[model samples]
Target: MILSLIVAHTRNFTIGRDGGMPWHLPADLAHFKKTTMGSPVLMGRKTYESIGRPLPGRLNIVITGSPKPSDNATLRYVKTAEEAVKAAEEAGAKELFVIGGGSIYRQFIDRADRLYITLIDADIEGDTTFPEYDVRDYGIIASEHFSANEKNAYDMDFITYEKIKK
Candidate 1:
Protein backbone atom coordinates (compact mmCIF):
# COMPACT_ATOMS: atom_id res chain seq x y z
CA MET A 1 0.00 0.00 0.00
CA ILE A 2 1.03 3.60 -0.57
CA LEU A 3 1.82 5.46 2.66
CA SER A 4 1.70 9.17 3.40
CA LEU A 5 2.34 11.49 6.31
CA ILE A 6 -0.21 14.27 6.82
CA VAL A 7 0.46 17.10 9.25
CA ALA A 8 0.30 20.86 9.68
CA HIS A 9 3.42 22.45 11.10
CA THR A 10 4.84 25.91 11.62
CA ARG A 11 7.52 27.30 9.35
CA ASN A 12 10.08 26.05 11.84
CA PHE A 13 8.44 22.63 11.86
CA THR A 14 6.60 23.05 15.15
CA ILE A 15 3.55 20.85 15.44
CA GLY A 16 2.48 20.81 19.14
CA ARG A 17 3.22 22.78 22.27
CA ASP A 18 1.42 21.11 25.17
CA GLY A 19 0.01 17.93 23.67
CA GLY A 20 -2.11 19.89 21.18
CA MET A 21 -1.70 22.00 18.09
CA PRO A 22 -0.35 25.49 18.81
CA TRP A 23 -2.22 27.23 16.01
CA HIS A 24 -5.66 26.82 14.50
CA LEU A 25 -6.35 27.09 10.78
CA PRO A 26 -9.84 26.08 9.72
CA ALA A 27 -8.92 25.81 6.07
CA ASP A 28 -6.04 23.52 6.86
CA LEU A 29 -8.24 21.37 9.05
CA ALA A 30 -10.82 21.18 6.27
CA HIS A 31 -8.09 20.21 3.84
CA PHE A 32 -6.92 17.49 6.22
CA LYS A 33 -10.45 16.15 6.53
CA LYS A 34 -10.91 16.13 2.81
CA THR A 35 -7.65 14.33 2.16
CA THR A 36 -7.95 11.55 4.73
CA MET A 37 -11.74 11.25 4.86
CA GLY A 38 -12.27 7.69 3.72
CA SER A 39 -8.78 6.34 4.40
CA PRO A 40 -7.14 4.66 7.38
CA VAL A 41 -5.23 7.03 9.62
CA LEU A 42 -2.31 5.56 11.56
CA MET A 43 -1.04 7.27 14.68
CA GLY A 44 1.06 6.60 17.75
CA ARG A 45 -0.40 6.19 21.23
CA LYS A 46 0.56 9.70 22.24
CA THR A 47 -1.12 11.17 19.20
CA TYR A 48 -4.24 9.16 19.90
CA GLU A 49 -4.28 10.25 23.54
CA SER A 50 -3.88 13.87 22.56
CA ILE A 51 -7.02 13.73 20.49
CA GLY A 52 -8.91 11.81 23.27
CA ARG A 53 -11.27 10.18 20.77
CA PRO A 54 -11.16 8.76 17.32
CA LEU A 55 -11.68 11.37 14.63
CA PRO A 56 -14.80 10.67 12.57
CA GLY A 57 -15.00 9.58 8.91
CA ARG A 58 -11.75 7.60 8.86
CA LEU A 59 -10.52 4.34 10.27
CA ASN A 60 -8.37 5.19 13.29
CA ILE A 61 -5.44 2.86 13.89
CA VAL A 62 -3.44 3.59 17.00
CA ILE A 63 0.01 2.08 17.57
CA THR A 64 0.62 1.14 21.16
CA GLY A 65 2.26 -1.59 23.23
CA SER A 66 -0.83 -1.65 25.43
CA PRO A 67 -3.31 -4.47 25.82
CA LYS A 68 -6.46 -3.30 24.10
CA PRO A 69 -9.07 -0.56 23.96
CA SER A 70 -12.16 -0.81 26.13
CA ASP A 71 -14.89 -1.73 23.64
CA ASN A 72 -13.94 1.19 21.43
CA ALA A 73 -14.60 -0.22 18.03
CA THR A 74 -13.47 2.92 16.32
CA LEU A 75 -9.98 2.59 17.74
CA ARG A 76 -7.73 -0.23 16.57
CA TYR A 77 -4.47 -0.83 18.41
CA VAL A 78 -1.20 -2.17 17.02
CA LYS A 79 2.33 -2.60 18.36
CA THR A 80 4.34 -0.69 15.79
CA ALA A 81 4.07 1.68 12.86
CA GLU A 82 4.73 -1.04 10.26
CA GLU A 83 2.08 -3.27 11.83
CA ALA A 84 -0.33 -0.34 11.78
CA VAL A 85 0.38 0.20 8.11
CA LYS A 86 -0.08 -3.49 7.50
CA ALA A 87 -3.45 -3.33 9.18
CA ALA A 88 -4.51 -0.57 6.83
CA GLU A 89 -3.26 -2.54 3.85
CA GLU A 90 -5.17 -5.61 4.98
CA ALA A 91 -8.29 -3.50 4.94
CA GLY A 92 -7.62 -2.77 1.25
CA ALA A 93 -6.42 0.76 1.97
CA LYS A 94 -4.62 2.40 -0.91
CA GLU A 95 -3.20 5.17 1.25
CA LEU A 96 -2.45 5.29 4.98
CA PHE A 97 -2.43 8.56 6.89
CA VAL A 98 0.41 8.82 9.39
CA ILE A 99 -1.03 11.46 11.68
CA GLY A 100 1.45 11.69 14.52
CA GLY A 101 3.49 13.08 17.38
CA GLY A 102 7.31 13.28 17.16
CA SER A 103 8.28 9.66 17.66
CA ILE A 104 5.85 8.26 15.14
CA TYR A 105 6.89 10.84 12.55
CA ARG A 106 10.51 9.89 13.06
CA GLN A 107 9.66 6.23 12.75
CA PHE A 108 7.81 6.57 9.47
CA ILE A 109 9.59 9.50 7.83
CA ASP A 110 11.72 7.37 5.56
CA ARG A 111 8.90 4.94 4.85
CA ALA A 112 6.33 7.39 3.59
CA ASP A 113 6.11 8.11 -0.13
CA ARG A 114 4.29 11.42 0.20
CA LEU A 115 3.83 14.15 2.74
CA TYR A 116 0.80 16.41 2.98
CA ILE A 117 2.26 19.27 4.95
CA THR A 118 0.48 22.45 5.94
CA LEU A 119 3.19 25.00 6.49
CA ILE A 120 2.08 27.63 8.98
CA ASP A 121 3.82 30.96 8.61
CA ALA A 122 3.66 31.82 12.32
CA ASP A 123 5.54 30.15 15.13
CA ILE A 124 4.77 29.63 18.79
CA GLU A 125 6.50 27.81 21.65
CA GLY A 126 6.28 24.13 20.86
CA ASP A 127 7.50 20.77 22.21
CA THR A 128 6.68 18.42 19.33
CA THR A 129 8.22 19.18 15.94
CA PHE A 130 7.96 17.92 12.38
CA PRO A 131 10.52 15.52 11.00
CA GLU A 132 13.44 16.97 9.08
CA TYR A 133 12.79 17.10 5.33
CA ASP A 134 15.20 17.38 2.41
CA VAL A 135 13.66 19.51 -0.31
CA ARG A 136 15.75 17.89 -3.01
CA ASP A 137 14.34 14.48 -2.18
CA TYR A 138 10.72 15.37 -2.80
CA GLY A 139 8.79 17.40 -5.34
CA ILE A 140 5.91 19.67 -4.39
CA ILE A 141 2.96 18.25 -6.22
CA ALA A 142 0.39 20.79 -5.03
CA SER A 143 -0.10 23.79 -2.72
CA GLU A 144 -2.79 26.13 -1.38
CA HIS A 145 -2.14 29.28 0.62
CA PHE A 146 -4.63 30.79 3.08
CA SER A 147 -4.95 32.88 6.19
CA ALA A 148 -7.13 32.36 9.25
CA ASN A 149 -9.18 34.95 11.12
CA GLU A 150 -8.88 36.14 14.73
CA LYS A 151 -10.68 33.08 16.05
CA ASN A 152 -8.27 30.78 14.26
CA ALA A 153 -5.00 32.64 13.96
CA TYR A 154 -2.44 31.60 11.33
CA ASP A 155 -1.41 32.03 7.73
CA MET A 156 -0.81 28.61 6.20
CA ASP A 157 0.08 26.82 3.01
CA PHE A 158 -1.17 23.31 2.37
CA ILE A 159 1.53 21.63 0.33
CA THR A 160 1.79 18.10 -1.00
CA TYR A 161 5.17 16.56 -1.65
CA GLU A 162 5.80 13.35 -3.54
CA LYS A 163 9.14 11.60 -3.28
CA ILE A 164 11.36 12.20 -6.28
CA LYS A 165 13.34 9.43 -7.90
CA LYS A 166 16.85 9.37 -6.56
Candidate 2:
Protein backbone atom coordinates (compact mmCIF):
# COMPACT_ATOMS: atom_id res chain seq x y z
CA MET A 1 0.00 0.00 0.00
CA ILE A 2 1.15 3.53 -0.69
CA LEU A 3 1.40 5.51 2.53
CA SER A 4 0.39 9.14 2.21
CA LEU A 5 -0.16 11.99 4.66
CA ILE A 6 -2.81 14.66 4.34
CA VAL A 7 -2.62 17.78 6.52
CA ALA A 8 -3.53 21.44 6.72
CA HIS A 9 -1.18 23.63 8.74
CA THR A 10 -0.53 27.30 9.31
CA ARG A 11 2.64 29.11 8.32
CA ASN A 12 3.99 28.42 11.79
CA PHE A 13 3.05 24.71 11.45
CA THR A 14 0.08 25.01 13.82
CA ILE A 15 -2.52 22.36 13.06
CA GLY A 16 -4.97 22.64 15.96
CA ARG A 17 -5.90 24.37 19.18
CA ASP A 18 -8.34 23.37 21.97
CA GLY A 19 -8.77 20.01 20.19
CA GLY A 20 -9.98 21.55 16.94
CA MET A 21 -8.61 23.25 13.86
CA PRO A 22 -7.86 26.96 14.28
CA TRP A 23 -9.21 28.01 10.91
CA HIS A 24 -12.39 27.40 8.91
CA LEU A 25 -11.42 26.56 5.36
CA PRO A 26 -14.27 24.89 3.50
CA ALA A 27 -12.25 24.52 0.33
CA ASP A 28 -9.55 22.67 2.20
CA LEU A 29 -12.15 20.42 3.81
CA ALA A 30 -13.62 19.65 0.42
CA HIS A 31 -10.18 18.95 -0.97
CA PHE A 32 -9.47 16.57 1.89
CA LYS A 33 -12.73 14.69 1.38
CA LYS A 34 -12.19 14.41 -2.32
CA THR A 35 -8.63 13.20 -1.99
CA THR A 36 -9.32 10.56 0.64
CA MET A 37 -12.75 9.51 -0.56
CA GLY A 38 -11.93 5.93 -1.43
CA SER A 39 -8.74 5.43 0.59
CA PRO A 40 -8.20 4.11 4.09
CA VAL A 41 -7.24 6.78 6.63
CA LEU A 42 -4.98 6.17 9.62
CA MET A 43 -5.04 8.53 12.58
CA GLY A 44 -4.13 8.67 16.26
CA ARG A 45 -6.70 8.28 19.05
CA LYS A 46 -6.84 12.01 19.70
CA THR A 47 -7.38 12.66 16.01
CA TYR A 48 -10.15 10.06 15.96
CA GLU A 49 -11.83 11.71 18.98
CA SER A 50 -11.57 15.10 17.33
CA ILE A 51 -13.45 13.75 14.29
CA GLY A 52 -15.93 11.93 16.58
CA ARG A 53 -17.02 9.42 13.93
CA PRO A 54 -15.92 7.37 10.97
CA LEU A 55 -15.49 9.03 7.63
CA PRO A 56 -17.86 7.78 4.97
CA GLY A 57 -16.71 5.76 1.93
CA ARG A 58 -13.37 4.94 3.49
CA LEU A 59 -11.81 2.72 6.11
CA ASN A 60 -11.06 4.58 9.36
CA ILE A 61 -8.23 3.04 11.34
CA VAL A 62 -7.44 4.62 14.67
CA ILE A 63 -4.15 3.89 16.39
CA THR A 64 -4.37 3.82 20.15
CA GLY A 65 -2.89 2.06 23.16
CA SER A 66 -6.40 0.98 24.16
CA PRO A 67 -8.55 -0.55 21.47
CA LYS A 68 -12.31 -0.18 21.30
CA PRO A 69 -15.15 -2.18 19.74
CA SER A 70 -16.94 -0.49 16.88
CA ASP A 71 -20.30 -1.29 15.37
CA ASN A 72 -19.51 1.07 12.53
CA ALA A 73 -18.28 -1.05 9.64
CA THR A 74 -15.84 1.57 8.44
CA LEU A 75 -14.22 2.18 11.80
CA ARG A 76 -11.53 -0.05 13.30
CA TYR A 77 -8.86 0.19 15.96
CA VAL A 78 -5.19 -0.79 16.01
CA LYS A 79 -2.42 -0.68 18.59
CA THR A 80 0.34 0.98 16.61
CA ALA A 81 1.23 2.77 13.40
CA GLU A 82 2.55 -0.46 11.91
CA GLU A 83 -0.70 -2.21 12.70
CA ALA A 84 -2.62 0.62 11.07
CA VAL A 85 -0.58 0.24 7.89
CA LYS A 86 -1.06 -3.52 7.97
CA ALA A 87 -4.80 -3.10 8.39
CA ALA A 88 -4.98 -0.73 5.45
CA GLU A 89 -3.05 -3.17 3.31
CA GLU A 90 -5.28 -6.05 4.44
CA ALA A 91 -8.29 -4.00 3.51
CA GLY A 92 -6.90 -3.76 -0.04
CA ALA A 93 -6.18 -0.08 0.13
CA LYS A 94 -4.14 1.11 -2.80
CA GLU A 95 -3.42 4.38 -1.07
CA LEU A 96 -3.48 4.90 2.70
CA PHE A 97 -3.88 8.41 4.01
CA VAL A 98 -2.30 9.21 7.37
CA ILE A 99 -4.50 11.98 8.68
CA GLY A 100 -3.16 13.12 12.02
CA GLY A 101 -2.72 15.34 15.11
CA GLY A 102 1.06 15.29 15.76
CA SER A 103 2.70 12.20 17.22
CA ILE A 104 1.03 10.03 14.62
CA TYR A 105 2.54 12.15 11.88
CA ARG A 106 5.94 11.90 13.47
CA GLN A 107 5.59 8.13 13.63
CA PHE A 108 4.71 7.69 9.95
CA ILE A 109 6.22 10.68 8.16
CA ASP A 110 9.42 8.83 7.46
CA ARG A 111 7.41 6.00 5.91
CA ALA A 112 5.12 8.21 3.89
CA ASP A 113 5.45 7.99 0.12
CA ARG A 114 3.47 11.12 -0.59
CA LEU A 115 2.21 14.25 1.15
CA TYR A 116 -0.84 16.38 0.47
CA ILE A 117 -0.25 19.58 2.37
CA THR A 118 -2.37 22.69 2.63
CA LEU A 119 -0.08 25.53 3.62
CA ILE A 120 -2.03 28.34 5.25
CA ASP A 121 -0.30 31.69 4.94
CA ALA A 122 -0.97 32.94 8.45
CA ASP A 123 0.67 32.59 11.84
CA ILE A 124 -2.24 31.27 13.82
CA GLU A 125 -1.64 30.52 17.48
CA GLY A 126 -2.25 26.94 18.50
CA ASP A 127 -1.12 24.35 21.05
CA THR A 128 -1.08 21.41 18.63
CA THR A 129 1.29 21.55 15.68
CA PHE A 130 2.39 19.58 12.61
CA PRO A 131 5.81 18.01 12.91
CA GLU A 132 8.71 19.82 11.31
CA TYR A 133 10.03 17.95 8.28
CA ASP A 134 12.87 18.34 5.80
CA VAL A 135 11.53 19.39 2.41
CA ARG A 136 14.62 17.98 0.76
CA ASP A 137 13.22 14.53 1.40
CA TYR A 138 10.44 15.06 -1.10
CA GLY A 139 9.86 16.69 -4.48
CA ILE A 140 6.88 18.89 -5.25
CA ILE A 141 4.51 17.20 -7.67
CA ALA A 142 1.93 19.93 -7.92
CA SER A 143 0.77 23.14 -6.25
CA GLU A 144 -2.25 25.44 -6.33
CA HIS A 145 -2.47 28.81 -4.62
CA PHE A 146 -5.76 30.18 -3.36
CA SER A 147 -6.33 33.68 -2.08
CA ALA A 148 -8.07 34.27 1.24
CA ASN A 149 -11.84 34.44 1.07
CA GLU A 150 -14.66 35.25 3.47
CA LYS A 151 -14.90 31.64 4.60
CA ASN A 152 -11.24 30.64 4.25
CA ALA A 153 -9.75 33.35 6.49
CA TYR A 154 -6.26 33.11 5.00
CA ASP A 155 -4.46 32.52 1.75
CA MET A 156 -3.40 28.92 1.29
CA ASP A 157 -1.41 26.73 -1.05
CA PHE A 158 -2.35 23.15 -1.76
CA ILE A 159 0.80 21.16 -2.53
CA THR A 160 1.44 17.58 -3.40
CA TYR A 161 4.88 16.10 -2.78
CA GLU A 162 6.33 12.76 -3.78
CA LYS A 163 9.17 11.25 -1.78
CA ILE A 164 12.45 11.47 -3.65
CA LYS A 165 14.12 8.16 -4.31
CA LYS A 166 17.47 7.70 -2.56
Candidate 3:
Protein backbone atom coordinates (compact mmCIF):
# COMPACT_ATOMS: atom_id res chain seq x y z
CA MET A 1 0.00 0.00 0.00
CA ILE A 2 1.16 3.53 -0.80
CA LEU A 3 0.19 5.89 2.01
CA SER A 4 0.40 9.66 1.59
CA LEU A 5 -0.31 12.51 3.97
CA ILE A 6 -2.55 15.32 2.77
CA VAL A 7 -2.52 18.29 5.17
CA ALA A 8 -2.33 22.04 5.47
CA HIS A 9 0.19 23.00 8.11
CA THR A 10 0.99 26.32 9.66
CA ARG A 11 4.49 27.70 9.95
CA ASN A 12 4.99 25.53 13.01
CA PHE A 13 3.11 22.58 11.52
CA THR A 14 -0.08 23.39 13.40
CA ILE A 15 -3.08 21.62 11.85
CA GLY A 16 -6.08 22.56 13.93
CA ARG A 17 -7.60 24.05 17.05
CA ASP A 18 -10.96 23.22 18.68
CA GLY A 19 -11.52 20.37 16.17
CA GLY A 20 -11.70 22.58 13.07
CA MET A 21 -8.87 23.76 10.91
CA PRO A 22 -7.04 26.89 12.17
CA TRP A 23 -7.11 28.68 8.87
CA HIS A 24 -9.11 28.75 5.61
CA LEU A 25 -7.31 29.08 2.32
CA PRO A 26 -9.36 28.58 -0.80
CA ALA A 27 -6.29 27.70 -2.78
CA ASP A 28 -5.30 25.04 -0.32
CA LEU A 29 -8.80 23.63 -0.24
CA ALA A 30 -8.83 23.47 -4.00
CA HIS A 31 -5.47 21.77 -4.04
CA PHE A 32 -6.67 19.19 -1.51
CA LYS A 33 -9.79 18.47 -3.53
CA LYS A 34 -7.89 18.19 -6.75
CA THR A 35 -5.39 15.72 -5.37
CA THR A 36 -7.60 13.49 -3.22
CA MET A 37 -10.64 13.37 -5.43
CA GLY A 38 -11.70 9.86 -6.49
CA SER A 39 -9.12 8.25 -4.16
CA PRO A 40 -9.62 6.60 -0.79
CA VAL A 41 -9.07 8.87 2.20
CA LEU A 42 -8.26 7.23 5.51
CA MET A 43 -8.81 9.08 8.76
CA GLY A 44 -9.17 8.33 12.44
CA ARG A 45 -12.40 8.39 14.43
CA LYS A 46 -11.58 11.78 15.93
CA THR A 47 -10.80 13.20 12.54
CA TYR A 48 -14.09 11.87 11.20
CA GLU A 49 -15.94 13.34 14.18
CA SER A 50 -14.28 16.67 13.50
CA ILE A 51 -15.49 16.79 9.92
CA GLY A 52 -18.90 15.42 11.00
CA ARG A 53 -19.35 13.78 7.61
CA PRO A 54 -17.55 11.97 4.87
CA LEU A 55 -16.12 14.05 2.09
CA PRO A 56 -17.76 13.69 -1.29
CA GLY A 57 -16.11 12.35 -4.44
CA ARG A 58 -13.82 10.01 -2.55
CA LEU A 59 -13.92 6.73 -0.70
CA ASN A 60 -14.05 7.68 2.98
CA ILE A 61 -12.48 5.04 5.18
CA VAL A 62 -12.84 5.85 8.86
CA ILE A 63 -10.58 3.93 11.23
CA THR A 64 -11.81 3.22 14.74
CA GLY A 65 -11.43 0.57 17.39
CA SER A 66 -15.18 -0.06 17.34
CA PRO A 67 -15.05 -1.42 13.79
CA LYS A 68 -18.32 0.28 12.84
CA PRO A 69 -19.41 3.65 11.63
CA SER A 70 -21.87 5.74 13.60
CA ASP A 71 -23.64 6.70 10.39
CA ASN A 72 -24.28 5.18 7.02
CA ALA A 73 -22.43 7.97 5.24
CA THR A 74 -18.95 6.51 5.65
CA LEU A 75 -17.78 4.24 2.85
CA ARG A 76 -16.03 1.82 5.19
CA TYR A 77 -14.68 1.32 8.70
CA VAL A 78 -11.62 -0.56 9.87
CA LYS A 79 -10.23 -1.32 13.29
CA THR A 80 -6.58 -0.94 12.42
CA ALA A 81 -4.56 1.29 10.14
CA GLU A 82 -3.28 -1.72 8.25
CA GLU A 83 -6.81 -2.90 7.58
CA ALA A 84 -7.77 0.54 6.40
CA VAL A 85 -4.92 0.55 3.91
CA LYS A 86 -5.80 -2.92 2.73
CA ALA A 87 -9.47 -2.07 2.31
CA ALA A 88 -8.58 0.85 0.10
CA GLU A 89 -6.21 -1.26 -1.93
CA GLU A 90 -8.78 -4.00 -2.32
CA ALA A 91 -11.26 -1.42 -3.48
CA GLY A 92 -8.83 -0.65 -6.34
CA ALA A 93 -7.56 2.58 -4.89
CA LYS A 94 -4.21 3.59 -6.33
CA GLU A 95 -3.41 6.17 -3.66
CA LEU A 96 -4.34 6.22 0.01
CA PHE A 97 -4.73 9.78 1.26
CA VAL A 98 -4.23 9.88 5.00
CA ILE A 99 -6.26 12.86 6.16
CA GLY A 100 -5.72 13.19 9.85
CA GLY A 101 -5.39 14.49 13.35
CA GLY A 102 -2.07 13.99 15.16
CA SER A 103 -2.52 10.33 16.09
CA ILE A 104 -3.54 9.13 12.65
CA TYR A 105 -0.82 11.20 10.98
CA ARG A 106 1.84 9.71 13.25
CA GLN A 107 0.51 6.21 12.74
CA PHE A 108 0.84 6.39 8.97
CA ILE A 109 3.76 8.75 8.37
CA ASP A 110 6.34 6.01 8.09
CA ARG A 111 4.15 4.22 5.57
CA ALA A 112 3.73 7.29 3.46
CA ASP A 113 5.59 7.56 0.15
CA ARG A 114 4.65 11.17 -0.59
CA LEU A 115 3.58 14.27 1.30
CA TYR A 116 1.17 16.89 -0.01
CA ILE A 117 1.64 19.83 2.32
CA THR A 118 0.07 23.26 2.27
CA LEU A 119 2.37 25.49 4.27
CA ILE A 120 0.50 28.35 5.90
CA ASP A 121 2.60 31.41 6.57
CA ALA A 122 1.22 32.44 9.92
CA ASP A 123 1.77 32.03 13.63
CA ILE A 124 -1.33 30.13 14.64
CA GLU A 125 -2.42 29.31 18.17
CA GLY A 126 -3.52 25.76 17.52
CA ASP A 127 -3.71 22.64 19.63
CA THR A 128 -3.27 20.02 16.86
CA THR A 129 -0.27 19.56 14.63
CA PHE A 130 1.05 17.49 11.72
CA PRO A 131 3.72 14.94 12.48
CA GLU A 132 7.38 15.89 12.21
CA TYR A 133 9.39 14.41 9.34
CA ASP A 134 12.98 14.95 8.28
CA VAL A 135 13.14 17.16 5.21
CA ARG A 136 16.39 15.51 4.15
CA ASP A 137 14.54 12.23 3.72
CA TYR A 138 12.16 13.73 1.18
CA GLY A 139 12.78 15.92 -1.82
CA ILE A 140 10.54 18.87 -2.57
CA ILE A 141 9.27 17.85 -5.96
CA ALA A 142 6.87 20.75 -6.48
CA SER A 143 5.88 24.01 -4.80
CA GLU A 144 3.36 26.78 -5.48
CA HIS A 145 3.25 29.89 -3.29
CA PHE A 146 0.24 32.14 -2.95
CA SER A 147 -0.45 35.38 -1.08
CA ALA A 148 -3.94 35.97 0.16
CA ASN A 149 -5.53 39.39 -0.09
CA GLU A 150 -7.47 41.43 2.50
CA LYS A 151 -10.33 38.98 2.41
CA ASN A 152 -8.08 36.09 3.37
CA ALA A 153 -5.12 37.92 4.91
CA TYR A 154 -2.65 35.08 4.89
CA ASP A 155 0.05 33.66 2.65
CA MET A 156 0.43 29.98 1.88
CA ASP A 157 2.34 27.52 -0.26
CA PHE A 158 1.20 24.23 -1.77
CA ILE A 159 4.07 21.77 -1.67
CA THR A 160 4.49 18.13 -2.70
CA TYR A 161 7.35 16.02 -1.36
CA GLU A 162 8.49 12.65 -2.64
CA LYS A 163 10.54 10.35 -0.46
CA ILE A 164 14.17 9.90 -1.53
CA LYS A 165 15.87 6.55 -1.48
CA LYS A 166 18.36 6.22 1.37
Instruction: Say which candidate scores most in TM-score.
Output: 2
Each candidate structure's TM-score, on Cα atoms with residue i matched to residue i, is 0.93, 0.97, 0.93
Per-prediction backbone clash count: 0, 0, 0
Q: Report lDDT (CA) for all predictions.
A: 0.86, 0.92, 0.87
lDDT of 1 at 32: 90
- Pitting candidate 1 against candidate 2, the one with the higher TM-score is 2
- In angstroms, the error of model 1 at 137 is 0.6
Ranking of predictions according to TM-score: 2, 1, 3
| CA error at residue 163 for candidate 3, angstroms | 0.5
Candidate 3 residues 1-166, lDDT tens each? 6679999988888999998897777788888999999899999889998888889989899889887654654478899987988889888988899999788999988878999998888889889988888988999999998989865668888889999877
lDDT of 3: 0.87
Using alpha carbons, what is the TM-score of model 3? 0.93
Model 2 residue pairs with clashes: none
Per-residue accuracy of model 2 over 7-121 as CA lDDT, tens digit each: 9998899999999998889999999999999999999999989998899999999999998888988999999877888889999999999999788888988888999999999
- Cα error, candidate 3, residue 5 (Å): 0.3
Native-to-model Cα distance after best TM-score fit, residue 67 in candidate 1, in Å: 3.8
